[model samples]
Each structure stands twice: as structure tokens, then as C-alpha cells.
Target: MYLLELYQNNYSKDLVLFETLEEGREFVAQIPGYTLETEDGFDVEYVNPKYLPDYMEIVFNGNIVPLSRFSFNSEENVDIIWKEISNLSVKNDKVIEGYSKIDAYVVNNDEVKAYVEAREANYRKAKDFIERCGYEADRSFFGSEDGEAILYRKCGAEDWHFLCHLDPLFVEIEDVEEYVKEALEEAF
Candidate 1:
């Protein structure tokens, strides 16, 4: 199920799960007030990860880290709770960091590998993609034909300034659109 987040004024952030954007939009339409975010603008959208990234950002205790240059045990599936150990060490400019709170179980190895590859592939041409999106990267990530992404805005200047997923559970990429369509009844 895809998560639908709601930012109600003077209240706690709320999240609802849905299988598709249309479904989520429909649900939102019923709410007295709700916000539904969608990703738009891109030259080409990758629906799957085609490359591996040097590092993966996991949110822990409301923070993203285990940043680059850390001992990212490429040793295969080392489960480490990131937030529990982010500031435990520091060695000059090359300080050490650990995984904050990425649950290894939620992460599908195949999906992670694919996402990493795709993100890295886009890295070289990130600027081009930015230009293609009209430089309006209000949201850090966009939902493309490939999958969900992490969009790092050079400067935050748009509505909806970040990707809402990537929670502690950290599930793999999903074809949310397709997932929703399958639930509909046949017209015939």
C-alpha cells in the first residue's frame, strides 16, 4: 500500500495508505480538507533502479544519515540501527557514522540494488534532469515511470519540499499506479 500523507494545520501530520494516486485523490476529495501531492515534470522517468549508489539515506529519529564516506559495509546485508549510532564516533573531517534506523527486513535486496544503480546513473546528469524539471524541485523526490526517487534540491523554494516516504520501515519500490488499477471492476 502507498502512503498518503496529510499536513493538517495545528495538528499532527497524518498518513493514510492507498494503492494508487487516483484512489488517494478520491479519498482526499472526500475529506473536508486534505492535500494530495503528485510528481510532475521530467525529461525521462525511470521506473526501476538501474545502478547502485555509494550510499543510501535512511531516516532515523527524524534524521537522514550514515552519510557518504562512512564504512558502508558492502559486505552484504549488515543490519544496523542507524539513529542508535550516528554520533558514536568522529575522526577529523572523516568522522565515522552508522545506520540510524533502516529495517533490513523491509528492504528488498533486489529493489535496493536496482534503486541504487538508477540513482547513480542519474547522478552524472542530475543537472540536466533539474533543468528539464524547470528547476522546480519543491519535492525532493518524484514518482517516475521507474519508481520513487530522492530529489535533492539545491535550494528549497517550492511547495511540498520533500519526499514523504522512506520511513523507518523502508519498503522497496512499488508500482502504485498499477496496483490501484488492478482493483477496478471490468466495464463489460
Candidate 2:
């Protein structure tokens, strides 16, 4: 499993770091109001440790409300609660920056028809765009068949990553258009 560290502040930040499953459990237990109310229910909250001994801060209703009084019915509840909190803490760290789509195209004919025209067309267009934008054109084999071609380009000195596959005969033209748009969005 992958763990992401969200906030690392001075006072309680370093002590609250969780990079592994074990660390996550330890961190959850350290929280002042961490507990489970029922056998099946797993509810836990992170509270300032400094305020402990005198008062407990319960996290409920999306607010860190003070717990005037609270009690646990069973030890199993405490275990379940910590387990749930550990899982949530790990999930909160994963951040998705963006996503990219790859467009694929297949040729209509079974016979190998050199994709000279398509390759030249894409290369020309990509080259011109790159040159105009003051960027270098990177070349690479995306995929090739007897008569099909696939190539890609990135702006500037960036990597020339393949964004899609183009099959003139099998793939619909409309899908190819959408794929191109999505690829550009992902690239940027």
C-alpha cells in the first residue's frame, strides 16, 4: 500500500507522521479522543494531545467539539476504531495530479500498406507546430503495421510521449478527434 504524508507541522506534525501501516495505528492511538462506540461501528478522531488529562476533544458533525463525557463498551470497539482511522489516514495522502489518454488507430486493410502518407502527415504537422513554438521535434515509433503509423510530439524539450493509436480503417474518425483533444489536455 502507498502512504502519503499530508501535513508536517512542528508541534505535533513530526510525531503524527505515518509512512507505514504500523505507524498509522500508532498515530491514531496517540490522538486524544480516538475510540470506537460500537462493535461494528468504527469512529475515531484526532485531537490535540496537549489538551488531554483535563478534557477530550471529540470530532463529530464535521466539527472538533469538546467531549464533556464519553465511554467505550468494549475493547474490540477501540481496535476497530483505530483500524478504520489508520486506513483513512493513508488514503488522505494520495493526490492525483492529472490523467492522460492514448488514442489507438488500426488499419482497415489486412494487406500491409506502408503508412507513409499518415506518418508524413503527422510528422509534418507535429514538426511545424514544434518549430513554430520554438521547440525541438522528438521522433519515436509509437506503433506500426504493414500500412499503419503512430507517432507523437511534445512541446519544447519535453518528452515526446505517444498519446494515441490511429487506425484509419477500423477506428471511427470522431473518436480519434476526441482522443487528440484529450491527449493535448493531458500533455499540458
TM-score per candidate, in order?
0.21, 0.25
lDDT per residue for candidate 2 within 107-185, as digits (tens), equals: 3332223443554565556456545545455444454342234445544344555544444442323344444556556
Sum up the clashes in candidate 1: 17
lDDT over C-alpha atoms for residue 45 of model 2: 35
Model 2, 158: alpha-carbon shift in Å?
6.1
Q: At residue 24, what lDDT does model 1 achieve?
A: 46
Model 2 residue runs over 4 Å out of place are: 1-115, 142-158, 165-182
6: Cα error in model 2, Å? 63
Highest-lDDT candidate: 2
Candidate 1 residue-wise lDDT, 1-188, digit = tens = 34443222223223444545455455434322122334475222111112225555534335443333223233322221111122324444532332221221233433555545544444324434443544433223334433343343334445333322333222332443232123121210
